[model samples]
Target: MEFYTKPGDYDPINYVPHQASHGTKELWKTFWLLLGITILDFIIYFVMPASGLRNVIFIFFGIVKAYYIVGAFMHLKHEKINLALIILVPTVFIVGLVMGLLYEGNAISLMK
Candidate 1:
């Protein structure tokens, strides 16, 4: 399929230049926020004690980073809330499943 549009035949309704800058700003803002989260994760790695509490902190930061990355980079934030929720709900369920399995494994190991 031919992807390139003819020079004068561009569709302005579907692609508006004025609104494009807004998206760029959001992208950069999300990038900076994710970088900050990464820095915090690194700081926690060294300063926090190696305990379950530290694990929880890392998981919280990881979730925040994932939210922004998916929302902004994936362009889901621009879509309707229902559409975003449709994609996000399954993701959250999968994370829950993994957490449950890890908890069960720890419990079984402790019982032995």
Candidate 2:
């Protein structure tokens, strides 16, 4: 019998369930991808450019890493496209707003 046959049995805040293994190959692939992303992030941090361009590149890589983390490692890629968009839309909007604010703040500071 399934342990979590009933959906309500899972707690919203602290429920931890065993991950469904997608076999050894998938597990290895996920690990390798994660390692690669970490390396890329380290490289970016060391090669830091000016703030504006650096942030843009960092955010770009961050989004890519997030995509892989959510889609591949977390096994959500096969789900509906709308589900993925739902998770990302707010994040994208917030990032855009932050960037706009930063740009505006820099402009204001320069005017002084």
Candidate 3:
């Protein structure tokens, strides 16, 4: 029935929000970490040899970025393991499906 208690009833150990200080710090840390990874990816994109290997590297970086973005920004890191796996398992399959499509499309184009 009641949300906020009286001044004397305020208990630090009993109440904590999702966006606590630790969570905020983690969010910023994730932001900077992702920024660094993106910069590194760009450098690799320009410096690496133009080949299938480079494309695979790009896909690997993409998967890593997606994992961090989903876990941190989407707050899946705090979720239960089974719940997180529910989303992640389908995601792995989707990524595989995309890679297969790309390979098939490239083969078709080469045939043409």
Writing each residue's lDDT as its tens digit, candidate 1 over 1-112 gives 2233687777656654443445478888988999998998999899987998999998899889988988789878877899988888887688789989999999999999
Which ranges of candidate 1 are over 4 A from the true structure?
1-23
Cα lDDT listed for each candidate: 0.82, 0.77, 0.82
Per-residue lDDT of 47-83 in model 2, one digit per residue for the tens? 8866868777877877777777787766778667898
Model 2 TM-score, 2 decimals: 0.60
The residue pairs found clashing in candidate 1 are none
Candidate number achieving the greatest TM-score relative to the actual structure: 1
Cα-lDDT of candidate 1: 0.82
How many clashing pairs per prediction, in order? 0, 0, 0
At residue 37, candidate 2 shows an lDDT of 77
Q: Name the lDDT of candidate 2.
A: 0.77
Worst 10 residues of 3 by lDDT: 14-23
Of the candidates numbered 1 and 2, which has the greater TM-score value?
1
